[model samples]
Target chain A: MSAFNESFRFGIRNIRKRPYRSFCLVLAAVIGSYALFVGLALKASLNNGIGRMQERMGADLMIVPESSEIEARNILLTGEPEFFYMDVAVATAAAEIEGVECATSQFYFTSLSSDCCSTRVQLIAFDPDTDFVIGPWIDERVTSDVSNGSVIIGSEVTPLSNGKVKFYGNEYSVAGKLGETATGLDHSVFMSRDTMHGILNDAKDKGYQFLNPEDDGAWVSTVLLRVSDDADITAVEKEIYNRAGGIRFIETDKLISDVAVKLGSVENIINVTLTVLLVFSFLTMILFFSVIFHERKKEFAVLRILGTSSRRICFFSLTEGITIGAAGGIIGLVLGILTVFPFNHYIENSLDVPYLMPSVAAVILYGMIGVLVTTLFGSLSSFLSTLSLAHAETYYTMRTGE
Target chain B: MAFLEAQKLVKEYNRRGKTFRAVDDIDFTIEPGDFVMIEGESGSGKTTFLNLLTGLTDPTSGAVIIDGRSLKETGDKEISKIRNQKIKYIPQGESLLSALTVRENILFPFTIGGLERPSEERLLEVSDKLGITDLLDEYPSDLSGGEMRRATIARAVINKPSLIIADEPTGSLDSANTFKVMEIFRDIASEGTAVIVVTHQKETLGYATRVLEMDQGSLKEVV
Candidate 1:
């Protein structure tokens, strides 16, 4: 065991003896590991982003005013609030359709330029009794109802220090805050039908002319639909289109699935690039060690003359490889994290896709796996490089004439 | 019985379908405290002979017996142990490990032998004897040829092995360093270890108790 200690010490000294050669070996590992980590991290974040986007969209089909498809998509995708209205009678017609599970109406309101609001916010109102999305989340986070004078805010919304917010010059209780969905929903707030109408009345009293659902023939902005389990969503969407003229049926599920397919192609390209880098770096490390061992043949021969076994010599090589791999792996992981965390917004915007970091558990598990695999590669490289010495005859090795 | 003996030891090699003897059937013996010098021309097989005797290479036929144990009968690991604990080989030119400092190189035998490191006092004694005490911290690249040769000798003797085999130990040294190294070997042999030196230097014969000549893969004692 002490012999092993001495050999390990000698292995470290060997690496220190040739700085440039050692650096080249370590850098090969670093580049491979860095590429792998960054690719995996981005893939994980994109996957998570896809999930959140799907959850934030929470509707099987959305009915919007005719010729407002682009405007509706822009509002949901970018959170740049817009109000385009269709008659409230659209909800009653959709709910009466066969295979329609339930239908809910929502009013879109923006407070960016309204003097009655304390700050800019996208305020969306749903019928508390008929809503499917946002209601359950509010129930889980807070016990109170989103009734006459209270509102549920998304994670990105800010309330006063005392948990109150002023909208339309009226003070409302901030009932709860939503969890992050990594989507535009995070920047929007929810209110019940009566509370939203009361805010609209206050704004109207202040001389605002936004459409009012209570006015006969006035329109609500959107009607969300939940299709029955037994019904094909496409069939129901077609039925809704036939029965309800002057409204566009947007299947939110199809939107998510389409974006998912496009993101998968980007992921494939990254995977291919990562595979090439891994192979190149792995081969480079093997070649580096092979040449180093060949150059050190005479040094190893001298050790054998001093009665050191070939096994010990091979062990020295293995130690050097593992050391280089571990050091390189740690450096690579840190670099990957630093590059991703601070510049994630840039990556997401460049790719025109949503991206969220993976959970802490996933990051740790993946990081460990990366380090372990690279270390094993390093060990295998050393083993292949030193196979000749492991089986060499001491006489021939010594006679090689160093 | 001799302290170390070779009974008709032979080593042969095949090259391009022809077999030739590197060390032909030869019998030799030396007692503890003996200082033996072997002189030969290039390719005369003096180095091969030393390799055979020390178990560095397997004999094609016949066998070597050290302290009554046949080297041919021992396993590879056992042979390595025998080599580590009983024999030390110092090869020609630049044998010191370049990565290790002089002191670490001298302590290397114990490391390979799996023995506890020798105390610094004993190490200083050996280094002082070889006049390398002041050069312990220096790496092999920093040492002169004579200093490296002396350091190699210190490494070989640090384990206090029963047999010391050196192949052209002073081949790269100046006359002053060569004479000084031979004197160190002479003193080591006086301490009761059998010392065998293979060299072409006629001046080295002065330190030997017995001198042998190698001609055509065979050994004959002259003095």
Candidate 2:
């Protein structure tokens, strides 16, 4: 047999001899690694959810009424319907800005306030001619355009029938359902401006004067603007703020920064807990191996007398440690992957926050790294335990033999 | 030149601020095919002298030379290589690794030296010679004291090293097994390997070509 094979066999045999001790060490590693995996997966899923939100937003700057900027963002983050509107003329004015590529207007309307509406759902309306964000996405999901009386639903929007959703006593045919973005958009319904106008007119006929379409000052909730590739977004933002006439420009980057700031304490808690767990596992391994090495001093001394090099003896111990640690790591990773990933929806629901899991490949890579680090720590512990043996006198150990 | 030589060897221990000499200026030599035995009372430093000769412990004042190489002149790797290739040591008591089977214990020298383990025929030959062929698959815990001693001796000779230093190879064995172990060492020495055994049993000294008695860290030849 090869030298490595021989040493590995000896290491395995030693571990088998003390199954309880080995089990405790491995259990410590598993707990540490499992904690790390869960933390990383949660972090990755949250980041992925944020990424999808940013992608779906597809706007460099959003213009809303200066008084309702916070409420507009709240409406986009949570599907909680609220009455917030700015002049529809803001879309045309924002389109005239120097660095603005395209400006699209969105209308937020709730069908749930009307007792005549069948389902309590937040309704979003976009102009097919001017919309650049949700329009292209809808096109990718469906072959036909959203015609006069039809609608497209978000992935989370559940209609009573396959082809129609009830809105203000009118049934609109469902064009298609969007893929899950794990964002507020998943809970909102999308239609053209004409359809939104029809819904409002129908609500007006039913005596809801709060949202009449033909009223003197008609309004759109928000104006989504894209910046040109050659233009500096910060400069455009500054200029838009300067030219803002009773409206505010909220940059897309600010939304993410806001969420991070809001959840910073939770993130810090997770990170600190993970760091403590990792350190505890490492120290536990060191202590365990220290005791084991002290107990096995006579065995190692015999090996030294039997013509084994001190280096080889150290290697043998390290091999045993790494084997146990690696086994624990694998079990931990498999448990995390099987338990934490598939149950991500439950975590999302409990936290009531955005969460999207990373791809399988990314998770596997993280698992590999986790196992490698665990094994490395195990090897480090082994090295530390054998330091005395490296310079010890074999006769002393042999004299104290069992 | 002697096949193995110990020149002015000394070992000292410090306990509670007092220095005690364990092996005091011991000088010894053994040629090939020599079966040398040393007898000493308890705490007379026979094991200490054996440890020094095997390079398992460093001498405080002198060196052990094996095959023209001084143990003091070589680095750890070179010394370990030399020991693996040329010397075998059986320390006092039941030195068998409790975790390993009797067969694994005998093949340990080969594993440590990075040499291929002995083939089945060679292993069977060694095991049969030690009268442990029936117990090859058993752990050391299951073996009798005499059987463990014989197994340790089997491991020592399995590599066919040029020198074997055994400290009390039969100190705890019964007369029958003690005689059996001495005869095996004699046969090993006759095969052209030098053997040095440290023990207090006078009956087993008959198998030795030379016998020495140790007392109070000193050695005198026996007539």
Candidate 3:
């Protein structure tokens, strides 16, 4: 252990000895970790915020006419291959299954999207007035009487000119814009069930007809179904799968799991990101230890002569890497949160997409994994490099002072 | 048996289709408290022979026996402990870690071996004796050649080993620091510690009780 401490002391001193190379090494690590942390944080934040927003869907199951779970998962994960909805009948039938409670359906209309338009008008939708789950969820975002012809605008989606407007051509007022949900809800416009139906019927050609309406009528895009109070969620999910038949039953667990898999699985884009970050991390560590390795060759040779085992050298290298990695992980974690919050706020403002930091467990776990991986990488590389020399005669290595 | 002994030591290397004998078969010994000097020109295999004696290198044939253990029989770690507890080596050129303060550099050997030299009295005694008491905070990069040599010597002696080994410890110093380093050696030898220095400077012979010169990788006594 003293030998380990000595090697670490030597490692730090060597860094001081070659300030330029050490600076470049640490700078590379900080910046590389920064990029990785920010990417991870932003990805996680969006997933979390949208996840929180989707909680308003208020059920353990999401019913869609399209059974493409992978595409649905991807869309939920990274906003790819945008929203897919099913006929409103899917919701009404879903409520008849065992262990099921009330199921509600809603219609969504993509609002005016542009930089010049001030009145946020995205995801303008209608919810069934008698529904318990989906209707109440939107209630949080809408915060209006919602009974009359009045329309509730999101913080972003305002009137056509940021001025007041009649609700769905009804004689109702705009009521008022509501507080932010920090999600896509920021740009959503909410109106009464009757008013929303009228607008969707007018834009019915592209809106509700986006899904097959031939055998489907009184159609809606999303169905939020709640389980009975005494029913098990997992069992209810299975019941959902059995009853939905042709429709896609998205078990919320599978929903979140799919997102995680796509973000980090080995062959996916997350895999490409993983490869890039690993290479970058490896190169950063190698450059760091290599420079320190050259400076400390004599010290190591001397230690070997003084009796330090090769394993000891290897272990010391591991410890040194761990030390630096732990520091970087912690700093990177805090920096990641601080970095994402402001940018996320700006995203909510400019893009009207809400983002927030991931859960604490995710933040800590991701950081810890990152540190462990980099430590193993840096230590193994430097250790193998140092121990390769430990085999040759220690005396000769230090004799000519090369 | 001598305090330190080498028997029929041989070191050879084949380079460019030709064999170069770094050290031919040689036998020698050092008694306790001896002030011995091994003087030779550059590339005379003086270091090669010294390395074998110190167990820093393996001899092609023959053996180095220090105290009671054989270098070949003992493991590298045991050999290091033996060297650390019984002998101190001063390499050619500046031997201090460039980033450490003079005091920290002096305390390096003990620290590497995990021994403590408290700052209360032991440190003061050594620092005061070596005239480095005032320069404890300065790094080797800032020290003069003479001061670096002194600081290294202080580090070497901190363990109070039975033998002090110097490889051209005076080569880089001015006349004053060279003489100063030599006087420090004499003082260490006076305390019953064996002092063996490797140098090509004939002028340093004045301080040696006995001088051995290497010719064509062979040692001949000239005292």
Query: Candidate 1, residues A176-279: lDDT per residue as tens digits?
Result: 88876666666678888778778888777777757753672356889999888898888887777787789998888777777678788989999999999889
Q: How does each model score on lDDT? A: 0.81, 0.81, 0.65
Clashing pairs in 3: A45-A356, A88-A219, A88-A220, A111-A121, A119-A158, A120-A156, A120-A157, A120-A158, A121-A157, A182-A354
| First chain of candidate 3, TM-score | 0.54
Native-referenced Cα lDDT, model 1: 0.81
- Residue pairs with backbone overlap in model 2: none
Taking the tens digit of each residue's C-alpha lDDT, what string does model 3 give over B127-215? 77668888989877788877877787777776567888888887877777677778878877878788899987788888988899887
> Mind listing the fnat for each candidate?
0.58, 0.61, 0.41
Runs in model 3 with CA error above 4 Å? A1-13, A39-270, A302-319, A345-357, A389-396, A399-402, B118-131
lDDT of 2 by residue, A1-402 (tens): 788898889989988999999998888778667877887887787778777877787888888888988777766676556667877777777788898999888888777745476566678888878889897778778766786678898887887754678877788888899976767677788888778888888778877654668752368888899999999987876676676578877888888777666446556777898899999988999999988888888888888887778888888988988997898788778887887867866777665556678888888877887787778878889888887875588888765545
Give the fraction of native contacts in model 1. 0.58
Quality class of the docking in candidate 2, CAPRI style: medium
Better of 2 and 3 by lDDT: 2
Ranking by TM-score: 1, 2, 3
Interface RMSD of each: 1.9, 1.4, 3.0
**lDDT per residue (tens digit) for residues B99-217 in model 2:** 89999899887777877777898888888877899999999889998898889988988867788888888877788778877887888899989999888788788899999988888
Give residue A387's error in model 2 in angstroms: 2.5
Task: Give model 3's DockQ, 2 decimals.
Answer: 0.32
